[model samples]
Target: MSGTLRFLLASWKVNLASALEYRLSFFLLAGMMFVNNTIWLFFWYLFFARFPVVSGWEIGDVMLLWAVSAGGFGWASVLFGNFPRIATIVSSGQLDVYLSQPKPVLLNMLTSRMSVTGAGDFAFGLIVFLWAGDLTPRGCLLFACALLLAGVLFIGVMAIAGSLAFWIGNAEGIASQVFGGFISLTIYPTGIFRGAAKVILFTVVPAGFIGYMPIGLMREFDPGFAAAAFCAAAIFSACGALLFRVGLARYASGNAMTMRN
Candidate 1:
């Protein structure tokens, strides 16, 4: 465990050094993200200003959803930026080096890229979250737990999508669509979705639990719902990890005979 932590820290340091080499570009990327999310918030504010309530959710409730989802995504992008690109690595036969290493490949991938720009998105999400506050101590605790679980889910989904590259050769387009679909779902109130749509969102896609469900529990002070969301997150993460391992066993190096870059 200690060795793994050390490797991760070292990797982060290397990534930071590389990013600093292009400081202007890094800050510009961060600035762009800030502007994008701020614009999204503005649109929502305008939306609520006109409608006052969508279904039963207010502007603050919607903001909470955005806060958790955007914050969760920012963390994922910062910590696991390489996840979505794993497909490219596999397709390009770049995963061979990772497979030859003594360390865990997944761990290596997780720590390989540290997106400094995601820090801006995280900061923006947190600011919006605080500004929309109705959080109790318990709500705060639950939110933290939910955020962690959401990150796990995000990584899990990315892994599953990336693993498909092994069979499909190039799955980047599919992965992009999948990610976009998930993000689109989280932008609205879950209450607006029902029946089969709700079931699919809550289970297969899980955009519901990413933000809506947890925020609902916080707003309503429902421990049972919170517990359910936590359990779902755990199960989803475990399933995702298991799926990745299955995919790894089936992975064939594009070049089996030589150690080539």
Candidate 2:
């Protein structure tokens, strides 16, 4: 375990060095993320300005949802940015080198790239969340847990989507579309969703678990729901890991001359 940690640290250092080589590009990327999310926030602000509330949810509540979802998604982007590119790696036979490595292939894939641009999103989301309201001590604790669980579930879903590349051969578009749909669903209040849609989001897509369920727990302080969300996160993460391992078994290297690292 210690050796694996050391290897990951070394890999992160290498990735950071590579990122620093393109310092200007990195800064530009971060600026773009900040602007993109800020625009999203402004859109919500406009909606609230016009109506004052949407289905009983105030602007502040909506901001809280954005903060939880964006913050969680941003963290996942930094930690699992390579997920969407897994298809490229597999199709190009780059996964062969990872398979030959001593450390876990999934861990290697995770550490392969680190996007600092996501840090901007994380910071902005957190600032919006904090500025939106003054929470009690208990609310703060629950919010923290909800944020952590949402991050876990987000990464797990991405892993599952990326694993589909093994079978589909080209999964970038599918992954993006699927995650984009989830983001759309999250931006709105879950109450707007109906019986069947809610069921589907909770089970098949699990988008509701990302923000809806967590926010529900935050509003009502339902320990049972929070427990269920945590359990669901574990189940999804385990399923994703199992799926990756299954896909790894079918990986075939296309390049004969290039050696595994």
Candidate 3:
């Protein structure tokens, strides 16, 4: 366990260093993403200014929603930066390098890169949290939990979508759509989605687990929902891992040259 943790840490360190090599590019990418998220928040601000509330959600709740969604995504990308690119890697036969390594293929591949834009998203989340979240210890703890669960959900779901490449040959487009759709669903208020949409969010796509955290886990502390969220993340992760492992049997070599420093 300690050795695995050390490997993860070393991978993250190297990824960060690589990203930092081009300092200006890193800052610009991260800053641009931060500004983009802020713009969306501003649109929500304008929305709330006009309506004051949407399906029981106020500006503060919306802020926390963004915080969890973006922050969760940010951390996941910064750490397991390859989650979104799993399909591309698999389709391109990049997994050969990872498969040859002593480390776990999925973990090694996932941590091989760092997204500079994600750093900005993470910063935005903390800032939004300070602006709108509960400052108390309990509130802070719950918020952290929300972020962790959100990250896990993103990684797991994306992994499953990406792993489709193994079966279908190239699933990059499908994976991209899933990524966009999941993120889109996560930012909106869960209360606004009803009937079939809500059901799909909670069950099919499971975005409700992330979207509802601001109210369910942070505000009211619903144990049932919290447990459900944790279980959902666990199940998705397990499924993704299982699928990837099974699919590896069918992975074709792209025969492209690849290397790692």
Candidate 4:
């Protein structure tokens, strides 16, 4: 376990140094993404200015929602950068090289790349939290915890979606759609959804668990719901791991030339 952790750290160190090579491009990409998130939040701010609240939810709740959504996604993309691209990798046989390596194939594949824009997303979250989120001790702790849950959940769902490539031949488009849809669902207040829609949020996409984090675990501590969310993350993580194992068993090698760099 210690050895695996050391390898992971070394991998990230290398990735960071590589990203720093082209400092200009790195800063530009991350800056643009931060601005992009701000623009979306600005629109929400305008809506709340006019209406004050949506279904009993004020702008503050939405702020935490974005913090969790963008923050969680940020860490996942930065650390497990390839989570969303698994379908493309699998379908294109990019996994062949990783399969040939000594390390865990999934872990190796995930850590091979790093997303520059993820730094922007992560910074934006902290900035927003400082600006609008609850500034309490408990608030900070729960927010951090929520980020962990949300990040793992994001990776888990995308991994499951991407694993479909093994069966569907070229499931890249499908995986992308599912990932995009899941991100879209996460920004809104879950209370805006109800009945069958809510069920779909929890089951089909599982965005509700991420969406509800601000209210259930942060704004108001709901022990039962928090425990359930933790359990959901565990289940999703196991399911993704199981699906990827199944897919890897069926993974075929390609004749394409490969290089470590």
Q: Rank the candidates by TM-score, best first.
A: 3, 4, 1, 2
lDDT of 1 by residue, 72-131 (tens): 777877766676676767666667767878888876866677676676777766787678
- Candidate with top TM-score is 3
Q: Which stretches of candidate 4 lie over 4 Å from their true place?
A: 257-261
Candidate 1's C-alpha runs over 4 A off are 135-139, 255-261
Each model's lDDT comes to 0.74, 0.75, 0.94, 0.90
| Lowest-sum lDDT 10-residue window in model 3 | 252-261
Q: Which pairs of residues clash in candidate 4, taking residues 3 or more apart in a chain or in different chains?
A: none
Kindly indicate the candidate among 1 and 3 with the higher TM-score: 3
Candidate 2 residues 1-261, lDDT tens each? 889888977987787787678888878887788788889889989988998866667777778888888787777666665665666676667777678788789878777777777667777667876787447787777777777877778777878887888888777788888777877776677767888998988887887776574357667677777787888889888888889889987776686454321
Residue 35 of model 1, lDDT score: 85
Candidate 4 residue lDDT tens string, 1-261: 999999999999998888788999999999999999999999999999999978878899999899999999999988988899999888878897788788988899999888889989988988988888877887788899999999999999998999999888799999999999999999999999989999998887899999999899998899998998898888888898889988898887566765644
Clashes of each: 0, 0, 0, 0
| Candidate 3's TM-score | 0.98
After TM-score superposition, the amount by which residue 154's alpha carbon in candidate 3 deviates from its true location, in angstroms, is: 0.2
Top lDDT prediction, candidate number: 3
- Give one digit per residue, the lDDT tens place, for model 3 in 110-160: 999898999999999999999999999999999999999999999999989
